[model samples]
Target chain A: MARVQANGVDHHVQVLPAKGAPLGTAVFVHGAFIDSLASFYFTLGPQFAEAGIDAVLYDLRGHGRSERPPTGYTLQDFTADLDALLDALRIEEPVHLVGNSFGGTIALDYAVHHPERAATVTVVESGPATQDWAHTMAGALDQATEQLPPEEALDWFVAEYGAIASTRQGDGRHDAHIRRLGRNAGKFIATTTIARDIPDGRVLSDGEVRQIRCPVLLINGSEGLVAEQTAWLAELLPGTQVRVVAGQKHSVLVEAAEEVGALALDFVITEADKAAALEASLDAALEGGRTR
Target chain B: MKAVKATQTPPIPDEAQVLAEISEMIMSVLGDYAPPEGDAAITLDSRFGDDLEMESIDLVTLSGRLAEWYGPEVNFAEYLASLELDEIIELTVGRLVSYVARSLRTAATAAAER
Candidate 1:
């Protein structure tokens, strides 16, 4: 419910503080296009809070309640937004970065650039921002930009998945939400440089990818778009754990929230505990040195 | 600036008042997508998903508005966390009104006791 100006844009943010003694903070970065902070708000935000981990959720620029300028939608812009948001919040401690889809790409890039600020990185159904990723994203965004402008395109979604879409989140089928999503998508694509900037943005090289030293967890659905990247990602990052949810797809974050929430909760708690133990030992060492 | 008053208990809104206030909040959140039936379409049994066609995100916006109007005493996020996901998806306007009314009354009572 708060609007904080970060990176010179008003970003809508919601923070769910830990229920008891705070273990750590986990900032959730949601997917682009039809997605917003509400994706995590209703699913993982509360779960994280109840688990003694502060959850930070925010709408990406040009996506939700946040102000949307006509341009500046590059990968680096998103990475800078995350950095400025942390500074605005005055959170100095390293945080566990959890991201979904395109959001995961941004999180991975941020971790690479600022390894000291990120304790652990969890990517759900996403891979690092490589040249291949940019090309695929360009194709998808091009298709959306072309198809979503027509009113008939919205009708097609309503006719196809309208019935079951009501019960599901982010299904892009509910009549009002679908229509609104289509309108918003059309406006965003037509007005902004996202479709161009994202694909043309900075991509990590193999050497840069290998530099991430913190623990990384890659969660993907068996049939998801990026499931194959798990093996290569494991090889690239040494401290990596992989979990492929059976009989799921790209929308696993919403489709299998219960399992994902549990997995994420366990990972954050374990990582937070390890971080606390390490900090305590370091403090003890310093105290011992001073006394001697 | 207005002169500050000592701590005092605010009046607890009745069910109808709460309903009216929440209905206004919903309309404001929905904006152009609001139903043609207008405020009358929002009733006790009107489902947020099926009737209003509200995504879960609308609730987040509504919760923000509620906090603005009622202050921190009416904690919408905590109240929502108490429910199962299905219950939230099937949430109704009346259920929210009841929660807000109850919370206001509880806050008023606590303030009076102090």
Candidate 2:
């Protein structure tokens, strides 16, 4: 575990490199209400290494081992943290940006704004940023905070979405998380600033979609709400691929680790191959044109 | 909301044929959620949730798929809001048939006038 001070917080990150061949680096930004490398990254990070891919798993601001400041949990903060991590680690090459849930949205926004910094972007169980869905989910979190007592609410949250949460056991910390969520609803509310900022972001124009020269991949749960959206994105984005793991829900990274990791590896390798071919073709064309 | 054509030279198929086409279309788009016994008798009144166990996510996906089939020209959100499962299932299929039928009628009328 590596700790770096990013955005006034000591964010915890774990870097795993392949045994012999380091293909390219992957920096994973985690989802909401969860933290640390212990979650999905722990299970799937090695899979990346096994496939000769380097992995960087980190806790987002205000979650896990990162500094829990009183406020400033906007998506931009997370983006800056990612940028800082890359610079600090001396990752000169474009790294594959991988994210889950809200992290996935943040990754997408980052890639859109900074296409040059990203090799390719992969989002697991996420959709284009939408205010209504964010509001609805935030509202759900708030209601769960208010209606159910801390202990009871925590239990319900764990029982229903335990597999999704980063915590291994349903215990005191989980209850503490529930209470913190209840208390921090105000600060947490501002986290949706990205959603508001990108109201028209969902329906990307053909030109805008085409501008994403990097390959994109969206993974979804077979039974999750975002499956259709995932399929739509795969079709919409240029050089994008969509895959669904059977019997998986929104937490593809957590629930279906092997399958998700395999798919990610395949996409990265495939994108690399295509990029190489395109470069070769361009070089040949330029040479032919120059000779003529 | 265009008026249904009243021509007889190229006779319009009855409601049964329209319903069959609707079922086939729905099945193609909504493979799993589509009820096995879907037919024209599956009225606009038929509830996807109650009758077909179609969840909200399924409905949203179905709406998106329906939009793709009909073309980006269709007012999908308005149509989705106005129609229920039965109504939508019928209207979507009905709309396709109506559009084709209307175009043929208009062309025939133009030829006769000429």
Q: What are the Cα lDDT values of the candidates?
A: 0.81, 0.60
Model 1 lDDT tens row, A27-131:
999988668887788778888988898999999999778999888899999999999999999999999999998899999999999999999999998989887
Give residue A287's lDDT in candidate 1 (0 to 100): 100
Q: What TM-score against the true fold does each predicted structure earn?
A: 0.85, 0.58
- Residue A251 CA displacement from its true place in model 2, Å: 2.6
Number of residue pairs clashing in candidate 2, backbone atoms closer than 3 angstroms, sequence gap of 3 or more or interchain: 1
Q: Which residue runs of candidate 2 sit more than 4 Å off their true CA positions?
A: A146-149, A159-211, A235-238, A280-292, B1-114
Candidate 1 lDDT over B5-84, as tens digits, reads: 32564567799888877877888899898877634568878888778877667888887788778877777877776666
**In candidate 1, how many Å is residue B8 off?**
3.7
**Count of backbone clashes, every candidate in sequence:** 0, 1
| Candidate 2 docking DockQ | 0.01
Backbone clashes in model 1, listed as residue pairs: none
